[model samples]
Target: MAKRQPRDTLPTHIAQWRDQVRRDYGIEDAPGLILLEQAALALHRAEQARELLAKDGLVTRDRFDQPKPHPAAVIARDAEASFRAALRDLQLDVEPARPVGRPPGV
Candidate 1:
């Protein structure tokens, strides 16, 4: 019989995303790890809110029978912004490899 691998403590998507980010960015410090976690959670929240918005609608009728943007739209926007901010804070949103020195003829 094959030995069973231990289950991941984190949810599947979270673990997969975190591991991929870590591998892709070579994140090793505590602060980077924390920021990655924050970014992941924010992204998850944004996706969930987006899904709710899709299921319901982009607009809804208020008590006065006036149509307004769905509340989930705001939530999704905020969460996605938070995720982007976290990535910026972590310096993970930029190009992977940048040239180190000035041009030879400049």
Candidate 2:
């Protein structure tokens, strides 16, 4: 059997975030990057959890046929909370994403 490569754990958007952080705050240090990584990981986890919830539905039946909330819901909720806290702690003061295409007054 061929040896499987280890999974890449880095967030897909880390580069974009890093660039913004560097441009806006001049933070190119280990601590800042670590915090950013944490935030990104939390967001990734939350997204994955949400996907699972969507696939499984919001509520599911147990072995007893009793309806219960999808377990992924909690994971998504907690991960989202973690992402928010990490962003807050980073203190980058990022602006909200602007609407795409066309200038507002053009």
- Alpha-carbon lDDT, every model: 0.86, 0.79
Report residue 64 deviation for candidate 2 (angstroms).
1.2
Candidate 1 Cα RMSD (Å): 8.5
Q: Ten residues in a row with the worst lDDT in model 2?
A: 7-16
Clashing pairs in 1: none
Error of 2 at 6 (Å): 5.7
- Scored against the true structure, residue 100 in model 1 reaches a CA lDDT of 82
Q: What TM-score does each of the candidates earn?
A: 0.73, 0.69
Q: TM-score: which candidate is best?
A: 1
Residue-by-residue lDDT tens digits, candidate 1, 1-106: 9999884255678769888999999999999998988888888888888899989989999999999999999999999889889999988754477678996788
TM-score for candidate 1? 0.73
* lDDT for predicted candidate 1 compared with the true structure: 0.86
